[model samples]
Target: MDLRHLLAHEVAAGIIATGIEGAYDSVSCSTAGNYPSMGVSQWEGGRGDNLLSWIDGGRKFIGRTYSDIVNSGELDELRAALDSEQGRAAQLEILAADCLDYVDALMPYLNDSKCVIYAAMWCPTSTNVVRVFVRNRKSWGYDVNNLSALADVFADEYYKAAAVGAMYRQGYSNRAYNTYNYLVTHEIAWELLDA
Candidate 1:
């Protein structure tokens, strides 16, 4: 029941929901552009120096949580233990001793500008997008200038395609955003003891 696993599942759900891989594949990671991002969060590397910054943000989480273990100057010992026969148990013990409940630690991350934008981009329901926007404003310490307009744009695109009966017939298309929302609010939320 480590928070990391639960959040991992939640991130996986977001990945499957967003078709972000498609977006990533289409955009060049090396060039600054408007599309193609990294991971489920879709942190757009195309904008400014954000590509590497996005990666560093994710790494910062690990670094913050395990700084003690990392900074103890015992990497050689840790590596030895990891290579030993009882590596699994030893590794778990080490990790448990060093890491906090990452799920609780993950809330601030969820409200990150990149994550908020991704949610606003991919969340099928306007309500959830609004919730994300509010969290970004109130809890995440973001100014959130034009997110309402952005959310409106997302909604318009969703309804327009739906009205045309475009991707609805397939059932497993981008409408999977519905399943994504359900899983995040239900399964992933339950795992986090939030539901």
Candidate 2:
């Protein structure tokens, strides 16, 4: 599966799981004793670090990819000709294509279970950006047939996470225990999953 697809699904799932009356960007808090979190996934690391990580990851990915293109002189000639509007447009087109290609290059390595963990750990915002961008693009009259497939995938992942959350909640109420105690008791569980 494409990384885009996986990311889209996760973002959608997160939106559905956390949405507040159609507000896709709604934020929430988690009371999970062992892993209290904020935002869509109840992500931890303090002060919404999870979301920041995702945004940072996107910036890094784009920067690294663009650097590669620039280093190869792939965009230099096009950039140099950008005095006229037409030339600027051509340069922008090349840049967009190069960026997409960079995204494509990451797809292969992202086709793994670790992608989910990585997102949960580092790139939740990147996926969220995809979701927002696709929706906005469609609203602006752009064809988003390709992203629709990823939206479907998002629905699937949402249900899966909901199920797991349900099951986890059933065994212990986060409200009843202190997060510190829960962390100690569930240390092994966290290690296994986070390992």
Candidate 3:
């Protein structure tokens, strides 16, 4: 199967086409990207994004919180570019920025940085909070067209969460990178084929 076309256009679009109407069609977007321990964020749209919306309260909170990281003296340059991507890409990028920021916020709660004093002592990497803010800024790019394409990124979060859990238990990661790498390859294929 052309996973790239499946992701970049057809299947991804199918998820949205069915999802926005509340018809409940979706694929298990992996929630990670290119790394085994990178963590996840929801990126499906149309129907898939709708599914995310069904369970995305936390995601919304993160977007606002990431903005706080930039605003609350954590870091600088947290502004969402309202006019960066062209057409649908702009919209997709906006959604991605929101979810990335939220997932970045989720990492700390998962890591329990509340007790790490170094988290509070350093410029960055000292705590999950600072780390997420930086990560989100870099992660949330401004060029995706179909917002549903976010499934590519979302899978990473789910995978990483699995990996971290596995690491703690038996020291074996969840192999999150596989799905991420697949999606990355898929997206690249999409750009070529769709073009």
Q: Per-residue lDDT tens digits of candidate 1, residues 46-78?
A: 321233233322322222212343465543443
**Which segments of model 2 are wrong by more than 4 Å?**
1-45, 48-145, 161-195
Q: Of models 1 and 3, which has the larger lDDT?
A: 1
User: Residue 50: error of model 1 in Å?
Assistant: 3.1
What is the C-alpha lDDT profile of model 2 across 46-117, one tens digit per residue?
A: 433423333422122222233353466544332323223443333233323323433343343333322232
Best by lDDT: 1
- The positional error of residue 116 in candidate 2, measured at the CA in angstroms, is 13
Task: Report the number of backbone clashes for model 2.
Answer: 1
In model 3, the runs with Cα more than 4 Å from the true position are 1-97, 100-172, 189-195
Flag clash pairs in model 1. Answer: none
TM-score of candidate 1 against the unseen true structure: 0.28
lDDT of 2 at 24: 18
Candidate 1, which segments miss by more than 4 Å at Cα?
A: 1-13, 16-42, 45-48, 54-121, 124-157, 161-174, 177-191
Clashes of each: 0, 1, 21
C-alpha lDDT values of all predictions: 0.37, 0.33, 0.29
